[model samples]
Target: MSGGKAITCPACGGKIEVRAAGFTVNLACQNCGSLLDVSLPEVVLIRRYKNAKDRFALEIGKRGTVFGQEWEVVGALRRKDQITIWQEFLLFNPYLGYRWLLVADGEWQFGTPLADRPQGDRNRVFWRGENFSRLGRDQPTSTTAVAGEFYWRVKAGDTANATLFQSGETILSREVSDGEENWTQLVPVDETEIENAFGLNRRSLPRRKAAQGLMQFKAAPGMEQDDLGRMFLLAMAISLFAAIAMALLAGPSTKTSSMIQVPVGGQIAPVKIGTITVRRPWQFVTIDADANRFENRWVDLEYNLVDRSSEQSIDAFGLVEHYAGTSSDGAWTEGSHHGDTMFGHVPRGTYDVYVSGSAHGWPVDPAVTDAWGSTETINLTIEASTGAMSWGMWWTLVFALFAWPVSILWWRFRDK
Candidate 1:
């Protein structure tokens, strides 16, 4: 009323007024329904806003592989709407070339057209499927200057596409224009049109009936009827096959050997058990005699030996001594050191044991003496000889055996 003249509805030819608060001119004619469009001045304001936000400001640099191809981010553009930030990035790739206005929002919406395709058609295809099929011909780049509430708060380097719409028509219907810019329109559909589009028929198709039909068609719990029985049978068969295969492939039950005797307070009984090679000055035995006598006896021992460090054998030489005592010294002792070799019979008492040995030999410098040396001091409890599947050893073997099957299954089902 104050500045712009009244606009007439294109469909009804009714005179419409431009309200101060709203940018669109709403026309309601008796012949035709309500029609709305932005006036020429409003179009100018919208262009100004879009232009202001397009000014290059910030620079972004990033590199990563997306969808198998390498993509590099060269620059970034942004537009503001109150607290919301609409961003677009300039991306480059060896395969895809340059792409501008890669639309992205806080809501995680992303769409882009092939670089070779027309920009206008690309934008149209993103929102509404490809238009060439429906329109029968390639639509020309939309040139109609749009208006309405399409203002974007501008910052330097922001190149976001501001959507402009008039009535129910999407004015910007293409991804790229002749001038190489993608735009979109945000047209609002009238209440009647929305209802019709959603297949709503007021008196004929009652809302209650429609809701009931929808509920009836909704997916039920459990599996789909089409293949439910077959899938369940297959699952049962698979479980049965797994059980049978495991039973067949499992090794024979390990035979438990009787515990061999280790004589206590005798010449160190020499026994070549496993890979350990011991030369006890008393009797040169790999077994600990004093530790075997009392269930929990701590024996002090000194040994100078060589450890075999091979791919198959990781030899560890130690006195498997245990003890139970309040004081370290007063518990027990038969300290006997005969010619550089020390041997002692100790009761349940904490006694120190030492082992000095070389594992492997110096590779780089052969002259380097005793380069590979390892020592492990452990405190153990000598329990009564109980015959059980050494849980630790059995678990280690189980883990090794199942590793291959577990890895294969993981690889097969990882994506699903």
Candidate 2:
């Protein structure tokens, strides 16, 4: 049952039902479409909507149960933005206050006015610990039509600025004017639920026509979605073939190894390894070092590759160590006995390799002695190789190929 009051429209002498009673401030004459102020004891004319043709799915005073709550449709407004037009139905329950049902693009959403402001700047906001990104700049919106009863003095051609932020299915909308600001939280409502609740015929419901111009994309003449898909596949195939060919052409590798002995607490002179010849214009050189069965000792090695022609040195470094001891958790071992380093973009050249290193014992073991009495020494082997290609370059090529098609898709459907 509607807890409403019936009044006479002073402009057209039509009987109007004020559904919200004490809360309703303005109402439209259903017969003459004259705006009337209902807040005062006597109704006063505000404006006349010339040639008004009301086309609404739910009439004023219609009762519906939504979200398990009984609500009456008290008012309705047809609003428009720069791109499209939609309708908003004002719902009222004596105990639950006011809510909104927004219809756009043949879809529906239930809106609840937010009491607390969301946290963030205009570009982004956080609500309930979730982040929302702003959809676009503020849009200018105008009320083009009004019907039934409303709490505020609503009239046609009323304007405001609206901004929207969205995270997944939830949307936050802010509408501001010089005098007032309002925020609403909106969530999608199923069409079936709405139809059952309002006794609506889905086939008779009015749907806004699809928007045109730049909002939608069309394929170029003689090109279809299938053609674009084939082109994308061909581009990927070409990149794949090029990557495989580069990998197969890395050629054979040249290896050179040498062993060196370092006295504890002292440095060893640089040792010369065999020369490396690069057959490719550019390649990567790898150095490997191993110190075996050495406990609590570390050796640091520096490598220098001097080109035979220009004497330009390309330098690199490596470290190898092995330590074992007993702790609260039984025996524990740390550090590696072997390490490797790689140098890239070494231009074509015949280079002579030199290796120098230093050795140190952990905790400064003073009583330690080796076969060379009173002098503890650790022996380590160093190896160098040439002509290997980098995996980094291969992955980079693959990324570029896939990114091209993705960028094209984004450009075409950005507005949609």
Candidate 3:
């Protein structure tokens, strides 16, 4: 509001200019520390900052560039709560009307009014997909204690209040003062950067780092979930494929067997199940037995694998038993109805299985047991296969299934 109007301060007799382009209606006289209202032709005194000290390390009327544009320090205002006081340096550029650099205690933050910007939702504002919430604490009205030339006529005792909201890396602030409402974006700044930006001394003011409110949250990390999710999916697919390939190369298992029968009161002869040829030196072998009697019965067998080339026999055993009972609590089951034994790392050779087994009826008890009084039949089977490839692939498949989700979660949180 440059109407080219000028007035003389009544208290200090200093010439004061007035602008009607904006809502300026008051002015402060620098010479005698008088606040004058020039709304009318005759200037009037409003109030004064009594015995105010020169608090600014960089005084008003200073000119500098900030955020890559030229700006001038038009006015400096000091506001206070009951316990602490902070300062806002008013910066103005002809093209960019106004912005603020706030200094509270030793903390610093750059703030600029969201001037002429389209409004977002008042109830729910989001920036870069981050939702903003009110800080929940109300800012008390702070009266302007000092001032210089202003676009708006600023007088002593003019008060303003600010409400804060947080949106991701930025802080959104709403200021309400002097019947004016404007939203502002706030970014954290350190004392050194502030001084360097404004061309002030490095030790310009006390560096108390008054980083309160939303500024504190800036230290926390941000989540970048998409990257982690992608990495997890890729690793999971590769691991699964490798496991499947390994299991496929393990080849098939080969088996051999024999059958034997013994009658009641007759001698039972140990039988040879059959021979297994190990094509690879470190393959695995398995021995199995199926035994039964006419009466309800179970069988226990002692087995051996004799390598024909080395004449070395491996000692092993197996049991096939079944028992069941019903009680008031519930029905119960015990013992396995099948029996088998596995041997790993068998040297390359032909091997034969020698087995001997005894049968028992259900009427027998553990404390006192007897062999079957009738004939029993038994069948033995021996199988061998390559050990390394099959087991490695199976284990890899199991591990990939278990670890895929964990890899995603682990990086997701780590990134945050």
lDDT of each: 0.31, 0.81, 0.61
Query: Rank by TM-score, descending?
Result: 2, 3, 1
Task: Assess every candidate by TM-score.
Answer: 0.19, 0.51, 0.41
Give the Cα-based TM-score of candidate 1 against the true structure.
Answer: 0.19
Q: Rank the candidates by lDDT, best first.
A: 2, 3, 1
lDDT of 3 by residue, 39-87 (tens): 6666668775443444565566567666677666656776764335667
Worst 10 residues of 1 by lDDT: 142-151
- Per residue, candidate 2 scores C-alpha lDDT tens digits across 98-123 of 99998887888999999988889877
Return the clash pairs for model 2, or none.
none
Clashing pairs in 3: 1-21, 24-153, 107-210
Off by over 4 Å in 1: 1-240, 257-416
Please identify which of the two predictions, 1 or 2, would achieve the higher lDDT against the true structure: 2
Better of 1 and 3 by lDDT: 3
Q: Please provide, for model 1 over 289-316, each residue's C-alpha lDDT reduced to its tens digit, 9 standing for 90 to 100.
A: 2222333333333342223432232223
